[model samples]
Target chain A: MKLKVFLAVFACKLTIKLLRLLGRGGTAIPGKIALRICPDLLFQLAKDVKCVVVTGTNGKTTSSRIIEEIYVKAEASYFANRSGANLINGITSIFIENSTLTGKPKKENAVIECDEAASKEVCRLINPAVVLVTNVFRDQLDRYGEVSGTLENILIGIKNSPRAVVCLNSDCSLTASIAEQIPNRVIFYGVDVPIYKNPVSEVSDAPHCIKCKHEYEYSYRTFGHLGGFCCPDCGYKRPEPQVSVTDILSTELSFTKVRVQVFGEDDVITINLPGGYNIYNAVGALAVSEAVGFRRMLAKDAIASFTCGFGRMEEFDLGGHSARIILVKNPAGANQVLNYLAGLSAETVFVCCLNDNSADGKDVSWVWDANFEKLADMSELIPEIYVSGIRSGDMAVRLKYAGIDEDKLRIFDDYDELIDAMKNQSLPVIIMPTYTAMMDLRAKMSTAFGGKEFWE
Target chain B: MKLSICHLYPDVLNLYGDTGNIICLKKRLEWRGIDTEVTLLPIGANADLSRFDLFFIGGGQDFEQEVLLTDLHGGKDKEILAAVEDEKVFLCICGGYQMMGQYYLTHTGQQCDYIGALKLHTVGSDVRMIGNYMFKCAEESSGSTIVGFENHSGRTYLGEGVSPLGTVLHGFGNNGEDHTEGARFKNVFGAYCHGPMLPKNPEFADLILQTALSRRYPGTVLPPLGDGLEINAHDHMADRMEKQ
Candidate 1:
């Protein structure tokens, strides 16, 4: 039976490889075929490679990418699904991609970034040594329910893997408020920047509290709701962080000097990724690396060299016009984009597109919470704006309430019309779009203007 | 007449663009020459509740709802409630709607009592009521589909004989118990219809303004429908029929 299963798995890979060569949806093809044939193929195949899994509501993709790169430098020989295939089938496809003809994986470690709700199935298949939880927010409410309920799902995976968990401490109150009910190795990482403004990473969850049934009092807001916070009521405060973001400065467009807290001293870690938000993600990667036995020095060296991964904080030049594409999936991310744009004096029009895709969170209502209206000064900075998406009118209303002059806003539901307006208009465009909408816009632009390499 | 619209903790519950309701109301009222000013009441600070002709609250997490509840519970909000009962218009949604009620029971089984404005009780923490919710005013000829998402665990229950905000056309609006989601108290408007409640349905927003206006200016009649009102009303009625 085992021999038959292994052969079937191997044959399925051939189909996936052929499909991949054809430039179709190749990643999940082989895995789905094999899994359909032999349900237990995942457990059998991952026997040799040590697996390290990362799952959370946000930052899993970026955190896993950084960890994968760290292993790449370690030259331990690893296989990773780099294209953000986070679901059960997605991880299976990754396992198939790196498997041998004899159904053997060719890596020392197979680090996977699994989807938050799908972590249970993956853990059941291959028990991992380390799991990194980034943070939880009220994201994709239509599909994922609430943050607390999603936390329950994450708790399942955490219990499944009891050996190690490098949990983000900045949100310890939220993720760790429930830790007493569960048992695991919980390590935390975050930045401790106060009395200054972060030029790059501006999006964070700042108002959540511990136990007082009130908003957490923050000494400072890092981005979204990640910060040092104490409940104003019963004095439930932020957990003392194990690792703190000591010092960070956005040195240039795609580079920054960030000092991270190690054993007892502040060590300077340089990174070549733009935006302060990426630095926070880098903070998560480093903390998880230290917990998983990767030396801080080696991890820093590997990370600082990273130019861009996935599609965040990535810059592309379509033509005479250059566009910086950042996935503005939530208010926290949108705030960071505004923060980055606020610093730039160049005449730039923000092209914000909103779609109620499941991946982008079906609730477009969260835009009101984003603080765009308060950044009305940005409207004056970049006068011409193109609001286009499934919920373009919604975005326009938000911008208007944020004190943005209503006259400055031009609404477009059609991507083609919006992109044409963008291309024809002389000013630089900051393309802040959500989920599949970003991909849709990217496809239209790339098809019209050669390919993605032009943006790079 | 300078009508002050107090945007309750506009910094906090503003998370879901719930404040867009304020923007919609303000713009429509202003367009009709009604002097409307939306003010953000800072936490613990006193703004003369008597001065405002209307009140607006958005949505937030249970904790945030508690924070605003605490601040408002201790303050002169009793007078604000009086202001509404004494004939001021009010509109609240989601967390805002939740906070205006008598009490909210969190999923963890803890109860946070809110400002005594609406006779509604909310039980939070547990399975959140999510997905796209459609709202059809029970007796009204027109309807609106709130095309956003919901992520709250607290199930709400209206007091006996109290009217619910609207009937659910799409999702589980007020938990599994009541398909009749949200609450409506006199001139006080509250609901879980947090699709910014207004931008998607401009006519509905105009109704809110018009209601507030008849209170402020008892004699003036509403102007003719313009822009997308007719088309939106048609689409909305079609939606209800499709649901039926």
Candidate 2:
């Protein structure tokens, strides 16, 4: 077993070095090779490191970044899979890269963002100290089958890590239901108050009660089926959150200030990122921090100081004009970004890059599910609308049906052309791209304009 | 002219932008100066099916479909069947399409009965048929080519005497085995395509609208809206499908 572990580590390290030399970014390939050599290599490398695994549909990367800040502020020795490589192979590669050739971890702690479907086996092997599920939304239906299947996958992960403290979003009924099934130490986090003045109502992924088949009744919905929910028939309700945003003091383009109640004590927290969705992520980060033995003030300060995640409201100065790339995959996330765009009073140019790549959930039908109608509703604020990517036509059609004037719509199949169009414009540009589209466009923008590569 | 559209079980079955069909139907009618009302009948809602001229049921996950089976068995199926027999225009997609069939046999050999509004039955498989696909409407229909995305694991087969809504031109339709895509019986239409099935295919959207409207005003002709964007989107998919 020891020989196998050592051989796996050596092979993985060699592959990583070779890939770097070849100028190829293969985050999951080396780990795949190592795992083939020794299937138990992850269990060996992750044995000594304390880990906090963040997994869910929407806020995994953002929440993990916030937790990384908490780790940094505390001056703890840690490593992270910060390159959006959340699958088992990618996570294994991260572990092996952070460890010695003998399959022993050099880092004392780790912050890992894991994909929901991959979390089941990854969490079992890593045996994290704290497992945080930000929230579960209907995402990548072709990949996970459905929202319930995603929930089941996460549930199995939480179930496997029985010793790990499970932190859940109380507002998400699908996520919150995991608490009922697991025997682990569970913590809940949510936003107590409605975050938006005018919330867009899309179809709820978890409309019926998990316990009973009855529809859920919301007292006040924050956005996209999340809020104070209670099932009338079986009495399944949103649990009282231990860490929650009690009130929103103010919301700005860059940040949001909110009064948060942790346990019984209340404190005002300035979430460095904007949008109501990030508020939930901030509170979720705090809850995970609490579970991981970080001080409340440390977590609060970390959230205040943490920058945005890659392609998540990530800013770039292109030819002296400001452009922000907001990654949108599913309806719930897209609606939140749309809500944030709606809040902007300044004239803006909206760029939507939609791809049907495997990473982007090939079914582009989700464009219709998201409330792009919000853009049409507030067309006075948005001067120009540009659509790009493999499915640009589908996106253009969706916007047309959403009531946006066809004259304002432009389709750019090339990223360079899309960037040029945005750069030529005077107004601030907000680019919303699907996963693969963002990666491709961000790479082009990084090369032409100036920004760090996503992995770096 | 006015038409009421009952979006049946939208709470449970609104997966894959399925409500886009509702948006397309509503917008097409409203664009023609026809007053349109959309009513959402969630699970356990007491819906008088006869009041609505058109009905739509989207798809859902197997878990949601399972949860919905109880509600359907609790007498809602009777209402839906009655409405289908009344020749009310109905559009069902994916799981909703499967539900309109007689029954669905699961991979585990468990048989689940549905409303049986059409002469069809489906069998679930582990291998899911998912991708962009194109099909041509049956001869009796517009015979226009329709493009949409299909993602389903249930292989549905229409019973004898029942006609298919369309023939698969490219990609897997009802099942990968058969060239048939969706079932058409009376005024009901069922398909597995949910690139929400309507917005991009303006002709199909208009056809459903015209059929529903003609119930109130016979020989109702829909004025053709400028479908340049929709046609471009549709052609993109059709072109891609042809290339593949």
Candidate 3:
């Protein structure tokens, strides 16, 4: 058994070295090969590590990054899947990479961002001390099948890791419901007050109650079905969260100040990122930190110091023009980006890069589920709209159907052409791209202007 | 003439941009100087179903489908079946299409009875058939080619009473084995293609509109609007599917 573990770790380390030499981002493949050699490679390497696995549809990366800052601020040695490889293979690789040849982990603490579908296998193997499920939404139907299926996957993971403290987003009925089925100690986090003044009516992934098929009536929805909700007939309601945002002091373009009650104590915290979703992430991270036994003040401060993850509200400068790329994978996430854009009073050029790649969810149909009508409403503020990526035409049509004028719509299939066009614009640009599209466009943007590789 | 379109169970059945189909129908009608009143009939919403000229039902998750079936038994199924028999235009996609069938035999051989509006039955599989597919409408219809995304595990086989919406040009259709894509009975249209089905395929959208409009205003023709963007988007997928 010891020889098998040693051989797997050695092979994985060698694979990473070869891939790095080939100028490739050695993320998930190496771990996959290691797992092939020894199926229990992660379980062996992660035996001694205290891992906080962040899983859900949205905010996994952002939530994990914030938790990483908390770990860093606590002055604890840790490692993470910083390359956005949240799957089983990628996670396995990260664990093996941070471990010695004998499968002993170098880092004592680990902040792992796990994919929703892969969370079941990941949690079972790693046996993490903390499992934080951010929220569940309809994402990548081609991969996860459906939203409930996504919830079920996370549930199975949590069920397997009974010893792990489960930190759930209480406001999300779909997420909060996980507490009902599991016997694990649960910590809930959510926003108590509505974040947005004018909330757009979008589709709720969990419109019906999980316990009973009754519709959920919300007392207040912060954004995208996250709020105080109660099912009338079933009596299943949003559980009282341990860490919650009580009031929003201010929300600027760069940062947001909110007063939150962390386990009965009121404290004001500043989330470095914008949008209501980040506020959820802030509370979620705080909850996970609490579950992991970190000091409350340290966790709060870490959230304030935390920077944006790759393509997750990550900003860039093109010549003199400013551009920010927000990675949008599904309708819920896209709507959050739209929510952020709604607050933009400044004149901005909105660019949407839609791709049908496997990572991007081959069905580009979810674009229709998003409220692009909000964009049409703010047509004056957004003078020009650029559609790029492989499915740029589909995006253009979606925007067109959303009532954005045909004259304002510009389709650019080439990244070079799109980036070149951005150079001439004096106005600030907000580029929203799918997962794979962001990689392609960001690589081009980084080369054209100045930035570092995401993995670096 | 004004057309009243009912969006059925939009809250539950709206999985993949299903509202886009509604938006497409409303916008296409408005473009031709035709008035449209869209009524959203979610679960437990009470209204006379016969009042609406056309109905649009989208796909949903397995859990949602189960929830919708409960609502259907609460009298929505009868209205849906009556509408189909009356030849009132209906556009049902994926789960919605499966609901119109006799029963969905689960992978474990568990039979879930659906509203038997169309003479068809579906068998659920563990593997989901999902991708962009192209198909040509059956000769009885416009015979125009349509392109859209199909994501479903249920392999639907049409009974003798119903005709197919189209012949599978590329990609898997009703079942991977059968080249048939969707089932069509009278003015009822059911398919797995839901790139929200209509926004990209303007011709198909117009076909549905013409059928519904002709019911009230006999010989009513829809004036064509510019569909350059729609055609370009449709052809992009169609061309890719053909190459494959």
Candidate 4:
């Protein structure tokens, strides 16, 4: 290795240690500083490791965790980016931390979760053995522009890694379209049956066909635009998935039992997480593991026992009352959360925290697209709705327009007061927070209550 | 009183929660005991545009805008022009606002034909002027400060025939080169604001409703509903923008 490479690695290592000592969890700065010294540090560090990169709008972190669980089950030596640091700089920091000062990778295997916008460069540098795209949705309009723009970014990333086997969600028309253009070996995973019992009328991010502008007709829809989509005019349709959820045997708040078909073989799997999106994540994880040449039974076992980390339906106890924090960034994801909320039979306290910070997309207008009006139908079950965060006023007005009674809406600008207000509530509480608000509130919740810090 | 709203290209030009403007308009009207009907006019939908009291068109992606341009050129452009001439209240936002002009010159120098309902034109740029923006309405006696989020690359310029909707108070509006934010030709209102441009600004929503109502029932006065929550929300956003 050159003197600059050695010095970059040493500096990155020292910065990580210093940050840990200071109780500050930041991977981007160290990786940035190291890259400033040596521009190709990540390429040098990640070149030797066999990586499986996960990139999509939603379920990236959760899918990465599930994939990591499979690696653990197989007893493979691997390191994954666990704390939501999926950007280029943060991902570079992970590679540096998992490698030696001589620029040799310490781990033989790596599972990387990459941001959609940064995936093109990351994939080109990492050159992963397998790339899993969970699904695509309208996410962070201010940051990513449009859903098609986001899809284009991911497509560019996949194009860079022609050798990598691409695992895609067939249900997502945007994701499935990648298979048609790329020469890479593609495997698809999706729910074969409709997840919802009732008909849904939510907005579709990909309403029109990707190939043509013709409207898509769905045989059955799982959620927002993810379904058995086919264009009448262009003849473009959903591809048959190799790994598919053939049937949802049972679904509960805690877990879901599904019959999954893996490469012509059928197996009844229990996804430890709830919701239909998690099932998609589970299937995508299995497809990626299978693409990476891992055993099907190991992937199934890992998914069956895996528990998700911070803010992806993370449960917490708020002074005797149970609260669940679900991080919502976009309309599609927020709609799914609202759909989950609409299914509850018991009365609950619903809290919506919206922030316009850089990480949270800066535009609070997406709250309107999220069909919060569905909550108005279940007004009896959801007694009170609390709007918090920096843009709580905007959220409060949004909920009011959604037919939520003005009497039911309360604004909590202060986090301490918001936490205190929910502490003594007897009913189950569901807290939906955007990215930045979730980070800040999760820290406060961890500090007040007993929970693991994000970096820990 | 009844107001018929034609939501143009709801399937294509519905970005950044632009449907929220329609929702706000509908709810605010319903609250005041006014009956309203909203019809979605997607591409290829042939509707008598002059029959509707109000016409609403929201923003869309660049690709979707291109799709909309084809349909507008097909025949809807003439109908929309007729509606504008008939004094039907029209609120077009962002891409929809851009389409109201004669043409849009894209960043790649490609010229896309538009509806030509207003005397305005746009030139697309590589850099998008995005953020929370505030502007004071320029119309006489309507000094209300409008607050909304603008995310657009198309810098629009008003011609001699049309007047600007508002003067920029805080953020970049319209071309970023001028203080003008949006264009106005009679009752037709076009702007880049899409918080969907009305939910936070109740006065603007009511103004659209009142304008539509007056067109049908001349000398009609709209009764004021409780606007405490709406005003609070509007003030909060305006204050945040002013502080920045």
Candidate 5:
């Protein structure tokens, strides 16, 4: 190794140790320092390690965790960035921390969740063995500019990794279109059957055909713009998936049982995560595992027992009241959370924390697109609605306009007061926070309740 | 009194929660005991534009805008221009705002013809002007400060015949260099604000509603509903932007 590489590794390792000692779990700064020392350190370290990269607007962290679970189940030596640090810097930090002093990777395998915008640079450096795109949706419009712009970024990322086998969500019209352009070997995975009996009309991100301007016709819609989409004019239809969820047996608040078919065989798997979106995640995870040559049974076992990382339906005990935190960043993801909320049988205190922080998409207008109007139907189950975060006033206005009773809308800008307000509640509390709000609120919740720090 | 709302190109140009503006208008009208009917007029949908009192057109991606341009050329542009001439209440935002202009010049210098309903034209820029912004409405528009989040690469310029909808108080509006935020010709309103530009700004929503209502029922005055929550939301955003 060069002197610069050795120095970069040493400096990065020291920073990680110091951060841990100081009880500050920051992944970006350490890697940033190391990169400044040795610009090619990540490429040098990641060259030998087999990596599976997950990138998309949503389900990236969950899909990464599910792949991590497969690695754990198979007893494969691997390291993953599990603390919601998916950027190039944060991912570089993970690689540096997992490497030996001489800059050799400690593990032969790795799972990385990459941000949509940062995926191109990260993929170019890592040159992953398997690249899984969960799905694309209109996310953080101010940051991405447009959903098509986001898709272009991911496409560029895929183009950079020619050797990597691309695993895609065929149900997503935007995601599936990548197969038409890229030269990489592709494996498609999606839900074959409709996830909902009565699907609500959603404002689709890709209503017009990706290839042609004609509107798409769906045989069945799973959620949002995902489904058996076919452009009548262009003949651009959903490609047949090699790995698919044949049926959704049952769905509950905590878990969902699905009959998934992989490699011409069907297995009734219990996805520890709930919602129709998780089913897609499970299938995408399976596709990645299969592409990476993991045994089907081991991947199935991992799927059945997989637990989500922080803030992706992360549950906690708030002084005896059950509190579940669902991180929502975009309309499609938020709609799924709202769908989950509408399905709850018992009365609950619904909390929506919105922030205009950069990571949370400074434009909070997406709250309106999330179909919060669905809460009107669940007024009986959702008795109290708590709106908190920097943009709590905006969220409160959105909820009120969504037909939520003004009497139930409560604004709590302070997280401590918000948590205190929910402490005595006997009803289950569902907290839907945007990305930045989730990080801050999760820290506060963990500090009060005493849970594992995110880094650990 | 009942009013008909024509939501133009909902499937194509419905980005950044622009649908919220329609929802706000519908609910606000219902709250005041006014019956309202909203009709979605997507591309290829042949509907008589004369029947609708108010029309809404939202922003879309560049690709969608190209597709919309092709579809609009098939008589919809003429219908929209005629509607604007008749002083129909039209609310166009971002991409929709650009489409109401004489033409849109892309960053690459590709000019696309629009409806020519307003004496304005948009020029695409490499840098997207994005952030929370506050603008003071023109004197004719109640002069209230309207707060919204704008995300657009198009720099729109008002021509001699057109008047500005508002003056920029904070952040970039229309073009980054100009103080003008939007274009207004008769009852047609076009702006870059798409915090959907309605739910938080009750006055603007009411302005559109009142414009549509008065056109149908001559000399009718709209009764004021409770606007405390709406005003608070609007003020909170305006204050936040001002501080920034």
Candidate 6:
């Protein structure tokens, strides 16, 4: 019976691979079968190899890629869902890509980036050896309901899985609270990065302490409550991280650089990503790799060479100017992009695109909260800012208030107009787009410019 | 010299990036040599509200409003009531406006008692309100057309004599009625438009800070904001929202 089932699955995968080779969207075919039958095979397959899974509301995509890159540098074959397709189909698709025709995976380790709700189901199937959660924020509230609910899903996966969890000690109050739930070794990663240049603190979502019901006080905030924090009443402070990222230099004139003071030695890693959150993302990766038996030096070297893990921080030379393509799906991600753009030296133009798709909360109010004003405060350097998307008018209004000059502001709710506005513009454009917006931006880039060859 | 600003429950009622509103106000005020002290008073933050010059509240989910209502209801100091009575500047937007009124009707029809500042009532239902919005600020409202996004699941009704912040541009406008987009009692101003409110709208921040300045320094002449102020071309959005 098992032999027949294996044969059918193997044949299905073979056919899909053929279809993919022949130019089709056959990537989802493996998941189409695995999510239904032989789901048990996933856990069995992962037992022999080291599997590190990172899932949370934010920072998981970048962190997962960083971890995978570290493993890749160590010469260990790794596979991760780099496309931010963090669901059942996405996980299965990643596993299938790493698998051979005989149902055995080619890689020794898999870094699966699971979605918030889907993480539990995928972990139950994959039984990963390590899990790293970056931070939790009030993202897609219409979809995820609340921050507590998102944390509950992460806790569900962490509680059941016997694998060690590399948790972010600074993810507000709830993420650290989950440290008590999991029996596995919890490796916590955090940063002591300074927010000096940024005089005022930007307000972020999801701040109530789960225990005392009082707002958690921040000694200092890197982003959201993902820094030193403590509750006033219950004394539930942010856990003392086992692995801390200190001496973090976010004042990078180029290449979102930071020196992570890990294990009594400063491991300086210059990442091709942007924002202080990326520092946390790297800390999440460095913490996980170090916990999973990779030497500290080897892990640092891996992240050092790692440039642009997929579209997380992909730089594109469009005709003449360089465009850093970073995905801004939610407020935290969007705010980080603003932070990066604020520190950038290039003659900058911000092409902020908004979409009401499932990834970008149908609630565009999240934008009103992002620190566009801070981006606006640094406006002397900024010549023009392009606000484009289905919600271009919204972004245009946002930049306008950011004290961005109307002439400097152009609203292109239409992609064609956005690309037309972007094509060979004199200033170095920072293509800060949401999820599917990137697809549209990439497609336009492919046709207008050369192709996805910029990624090469 | 310490001017206390009430960043009221920023972590909780902060639906939009209202924290940016406070950040913009603080930085701008500080730029003008005001010794600005921002006290983030969460749901149960330890701080004296009586010393507060500016009281600020952002938007949030209906559940968050419900959760915070009891705490906010209890913590309503006489100083806050006096501030409202005196028409001192308190910046409230969207859900904050809804919750600051007499009552907020939840989706289940339960009446949640508001702080009774605005003469209005907001009722929530199943259908959520989320989209980019614009508003034509009143003539006295010396600022650009208020442009931002409104994401809420509530409908607010302004009673007689109440004026909205401006005519709604896009988004759901103002709840179900053609009511005022925001509420004002002297220095206290409320609106639904948020793009983290102030970051994108320095003019509005200046207006709020001017209210603070008038209250604090009396007849002190304030210099106008320096150069780099640009006229944002979002009139198209206002035009589009008006047609809708």
What is the iRMS for every candidate structure? 4.5, 1.1, 1.0, 1.0, 1.0, 4.4
| A144 Cα displacement, candidate 2 (Å) | 0.8
Clashes of 4: 0
Worst 10 residues of 3 chain B by lDDT: B61-70
Which runs of model 5 end up more than 4 angstroms from their true locations?
none
On TM-score, the stronger of 1 and 5 is: 5
For model 3, residues B100-162, the per-residue Cα lDDT tens digits are 999999999999999999999999888878888888998776688989888888899999889
lDDT of 1 by residue, A151-256 (tens): 7787777777766564655644576564655677666777777412533332233354545555567787666666677787778766666776777644565577
lDDT of 6 by residue, A1-456 (tens): 455346535755775677667755445566666646665655545556567888887777778767877877778777777666678775676666666655676888888888888878777877777888877877876577567778889888876677665555554566778877667777777776554366334555546667756667878777755777888978888776656666655456445567666666666677665567777777788888877888777777766666555456676676677776788767777777777776767578777887767767665667766667777677777878877776675576566556666788777768887777677476777888877688777767766765452212
Q: Which parts of model 6 are misplaced by more than 4 Å?
A: A1-30, A33-49, A100-102, A249-251, A256-261, A264-274, A413-417, A420-423, A447-456, B1-11, B18-57, B61-71, B75-244
Task: Kindly give the number of clashing pairs for every candidate.
Answer: 28, 0, 0, 0, 0, 16
DockQ each: 0.40, 0.77, 0.83, 0.79, 0.79, 0.25
Quote the lDDT for B142 in model 6: 58
Model 6 Cα displacement at A15 (Å)? 7.2
Quote the positional error of residue B150 for candidate 2 in Å. Answer: 1.6
Candidates sorted on DockQ, descending: 3, 4, 5, 2, 1, 6
Q: Write candidate 1's Cα lDDT for B1-244 as tens digits.
A: 5467888776566656676677667766666666878787756667777777778877765445556666777865687678767868788878777777888876677777777787888887556676656667655413544444455677888986568767776677776666887777777777777666776666666667667667777876667444342244235434543676
Task: Give the alpha carbon lDDT tens digit for every residue of B1-244 in model 5.
Answer: 8999999999888889999999999889888889999999888888999999999999888777767777899999999989999999999998898889999888998988888888899898888898899899998876778999998888999998898999999989989897999988999988899887998888888888998999999998889988777888888887777788
Could you give candidate 3's per-residue lDDT for residues A110-186 as a string of tens digits? 99999998999999998889999999988988888877889989999998787899999999998998997989999
In candidate 5, position A361 carries an lDDT of 88
Against the true structure, what is each candidate's TM-score? 0.83, 0.97, 0.98, 0.98, 0.99, 0.75
